[model samples]
Structure formats: structure tokens, C-alpha cells
Target: MTETLDTTVAFRATMGRLASGVSVITTRTGSTPIGMTASAVSALSLDPLQLIVCVGNHLFTRTAIAEHGRFAVNILGEDGEDLARTFAAPVPDRFAGVAVDDSHGVPVLQDAIATVVCQVSQALPGGDHTIFVGDARHFTHKSASRPLVYFAGEFGVMS
Candidate 1:
């Protein structure tokens, strides 16, 4: 038999053990743009070019992404901590003064280490979070900058 976890406590402990790359998930809502700092993103496959992102059900960006049907994942560079926090907060104008442009109807941050515009291929309920599977249509990368990393609830820079 499989051992069941205490859930809440076990979840924090288990997640704390996993180190994740930091990303800024962006979706446009009407004329406004919304985004959030996320670490729970992973590549799913290369055949169809897919990736998975886990978003909390209550986040506004989650709803925006669903309605918009697409999103851009901006993989931040080492100097992007402030930009990440700006988008992650519950502010009215998250994209104000930020240099971003539309990429196939998705918002892509400028100077990101990498960016991927994806169409929502599937969405499913995953306990406290929703699992979003996306099919990447366009992608770009820069070899110059090091990526900003998130691990154990903190932001880190690769040296």
C-alpha cells in the first residue's frame, strides 16, 4: 500500500526539496497585461513542443490565460528579480514601464534569457493548482545571460 501524506505539511516539505527555474508567465487581458512569477513550469515533450505550468486556481492570471487561450513564458536572466516581483504582486499596472511586446498575441518580456509563446492545448484540475499544458508555437533564446534560479523559496543567481 502507498503511504498517504499529511497533505499540507507534506506538500511544503516535498516542494521545498525541489529546486526550480524561475519564469514570468504573462497573459494579456483585453488591453491590459497580467503576469506572475512562477517556478512550477517544466518541459513536457519535444515532439509537439509542449510545456506544463501549474498555476494556483485563484490567481487572476490563471483566468486571464484561460480566456486569452495563450501565454508567453519569459525565462528571466540573473538581473530580473525586480521585474519578477513587479509582475507577481497584486498591482493594477504590472506592465507599466516594462519593455514587452506582443508575440503571436502573447506578451513577451524583452531581454529575457529565453521566451516561449504557447497555445493552451489542455487544462486540468490538479488539486490546489491547475495544470496547463501548452503547445509552443514560437521560441527564442539568448546565450549571453545566465538564468535567474529559484530554489527553496528564494531567488538565486548563477555565478
Candidate 2:
């Protein structure tokens, strides 16, 4: 008899082939800052200018963003690949070597291609992750630079 293939592996392989921009989702509560490398993000609205990020339920940054009611999406540039990998790993103090600036209250990556500050408009449960819908508050206009892209389990610079 033939063995059944794992759907989970299939899903991952298929998605891995899809090229996507890299971004860091960040927030702070009190004096503590939180960040994570995320590729599961996209715009959800235009009238109010909003976006959604899928964060694991147990992620510390997810809880912090909920508590703080705010977050900033730092779009990584070609040079930000290292930063993206750092944030993706479970290393302590992901922001250890990262430089940031406080815009309003959100911590924005100084070297990011762009920074979009947003307020949490809704938090919806989606299986193992929470989908946070954020309404854009402030942002930096896109600058001249290539973005970091992830594809097939690897990182690359956009042409």
C-alpha cells in the first residue's frame, strides 16, 4: 500500500516557493520592546489605511502589541536581511544590536525601507495564530532601495 503524504509538508513546500517581502512587526509595553520577523502580512483596507499581521498566539510580541494597542511594521530593505534573520530566530534580545527610533510610542527600525505605525483595530483568532488588524497612524514614505525577499526557505534581495 502507498503511504499518505503529509499535508503539512506539502503546504509548507508550496508556500515556500511564493516570494514575499520581509517585515518586522514591533511594539512596546512600558519600557520593553518586542519584535518578530514576519512574512504573513498584507494590506486589508485602503479607506482607513490598514494592514493585518498573523502572529503566533504564544509569541511575546503578540501579547505586547495587544497590551500596547499599537505596532509598527518595518519593511526590510536589501541590507536588512541580517536583521530579518535575527528577529526570526528565538535568540534572546532580538533587538540587542538593532538601532531604533521612537516615533510617537512605537519603535521604528532606523534602517528599514519604511515604517508604518498602526493602532490595533481588531484582534481575531485564527487557529494557531492571531490576526491583528491595524489602522495606520503614521508612516514614512518609501525610499530608494531594494527590499528583502524570502522564497523557498531562503532570503534574497529584490532586483
Candidate 3:
């Protein structure tokens, strides 16, 4: 038998027990670029090389992703708090002067531990967000740095 429950308490308690890697989601439209710090990225497959990103339904970045049909996940390392803060804010033209480009023409931040470029395969409605499934087309990695992590509502450095 299934029981109904409120998400307010359940979500917080459940999230409290989970630790996630931090990433900066970046996208571009022509020359305009936007970025956001998120910890909602996850791997979905290996054979077909798939990844998933949960974007808030109401965020401008989500609209950008839908319109552009592509995005880059910049896996941040332990020293990425500054990058995280800048992206998480409503700052104007956050990618200005920063070493980045459309690796797949999708605005990937430089110096990230890894960059994954993908084409959105599906977008399904999921509570307060939309789950975007991406087919990984290209990827790059730098194995020299420890990853940045997020847990219990705070940022952490991987040890």
C-alpha cells in the first residue's frame, strides 16, 4: 500500500542525507551567455552516455536551455566557491572576460575539472523543476583537482 505525504518535511530530511558534486551550468544564445551553479546533475547511463540536469521551471536559464537545445556542465573543483557565487546571483553577463567558449558552441567555463557538452534528449515535468535528459556528445576532463561538493545546504571541498 502507498501512503501520501507532504514534501516539505520529507524533502528536507531526504536532502539532508545526500551529498552531491557541484557544477556550473552554462549556455549561450549567439553572443549572450548565462550561467548558474547547481548540484542537481547526475549520470543516467553509460552505454549511450547520458546525463540529467534538473532545472527550475521558472528560471531564465531553463528557458535558455530549452531554446538553445544544448548546454555545458562545468564540473567545479574545490576552489570554485567564487565561480559558484557569481553564477548563483542575478549578475549581468557573468561570463564577461572569463576564458570560455562554445566548445560545442554551448559556452563552457574554463578551468573546470570537467566539461560535458550535451544535446537535450527529453524534458519531463518534475514537481518544481524539469528533468532534462541529455545525450552526451562531447566531454573533457582534468583529473588534477578535487571536486567541489555540496551537502546539507552548504558547499564543501572534497578531501
Maximum-lDDT candidate = 2
Error of 3 at 80 (Å): 0.8
Candidate 1 colliding pairs = none
lDDT of 2 by residue, 13-70 (tens): 9989999999999999799888999999898889989999999998888899999999
lDDT of 1 by residue, 1-159 (tens): 344667766878788777777899998889787899999899999998999999999898899999999999999999999988887788888888888888579779996899999999999998779899999999999978898987777888888
Ranking by lDDT: 2, 1, 3
Question: Among all windows of ten consecutive residues in candidate 1, which has the lowest summed lDDT?
Answer: 1-10
How well does each candidate superpose onto the true structure, as a TM-score?
0.91, 0.93, 0.89
- Where model 1 places Cα greater than 4 Å from the true spot, the runs are 1-10
TM-score (C-alpha, index-matched) for candidate 1: 0.91
Backbone collision tally, model 2: 0
- Runs of candidate 3 exceeding 4 Å displacement: 1-10
Query: Backbone clashes in each candidate structure, one number apiece?
Result: 0, 0, 1
The model with the greater TM-score, 1 or 2, is 2
RMSD of each: 2.7, 3.0, 2.9
Clashing pairs in 3: 102-105
lDDT (tens digit, per residue) of candidate 3 on 17-60: 79989899988766688788989999999989999999999998
* TM-score between model 3 and native: 0.89
Model 3 lDDT at residue 89: 82
